[model samples]
Target: MSTTYFISDHHFGHKNIIDFENRPFSDVDEMTSNMIAKWNAVVRKEDKIFHLGDFSFLNKERTQEIVSQLNGYKILILGNHDRGRPRTWWLEAGFDEVSEYPLIYMNFFFLSHEPMYMNKQMPYLNVHGHIHGQKYEGRHYYNVSVEQLDYTPVSFEQIRDSVVVDEEQA
Candidate 1:
């Protein structure tokens, strides 16, 4: 089976990223290109990528240009920043699905953005983006990277192992 990856909160074209988070790139164009490169480096053409949200800072046209360069079947989980774009815009941008809640595969829970609280009772591993790899406690969460917002996608097995390691150390 092909591997599936999850990433989110690219915020491409957002000039404020530099001041807000001290992103390395001087401009959005540089950030966008670098993100695309980082993603293609790890993802195969046949792999599926699930982007949680905040794909762009400008509009759909700019977003589409960046999206076109990336490989894989893409999906979007709409976030606060993605609000107001037409539904057709996302459909045309080659997203297989756009949703607000969790997308599941083989009992793993995937979302573009992180939820306030994860449900431990569910036989699900939550994958999300929003926080930028800061301090947070959860069963499973993937923090966004400025270099490549939605570039790397990890498996449930990988996440489980990481969580187990964290628990053991605790």
Candidate 2:
């Protein structure tokens, strides 16, 4: 069966990210290579990956180069840093689609680049990134930031298992 995955804040080729996010990498090259390797290890070309955003800080050409090396059909939910780029730019860079704002997936989940307020009263679960290493707590919130997910794509199965379904919804 084909699988789906979610991840965000890759910031590929951004040297400052190492210092800004306290990422465990010696340099930008190492971080980028390691992430690509880890991503390819779990994501097959036929699989789908929902990248919550901040995908890359490099120029279009370099970004495309990096994205081309990865496996999976990528979908991007534009983040804070991704705002300046055009939708077509991301599509050309290997993303299957680019969403400018939050997306509703499978009628049960809200996908966003930044974590949004969510409670049991809400109808859908919120899955997001952009917080980096911040701790997220709540029944309706699921963070797929690279920092939280060990710098790899997280399977939808794993996320589904963690979702807290309300009696009314279930």
TM-score of 1: 0.82
TM-scores for every candidate against the unseen true structure: 0.82, 0.93
- RMSD for each of the candidates: 2.8, 2.5
Off by over 4 Å in 2: 164-170
The parts of candidate 1 lying over 4 Å away from their true place are 110-112, 119-124, 138-140, 144-157, 167-170
Separate clash counts for every candidate: 3, 0
Instruction: Report how far residue 136 has shifted in candidate 1, in Å.
Output: 1.2
lDDT of model 1, residue 61 = 75
Candidate 2, number of clashes: 0
lDDT of each: 0.68, 0.89
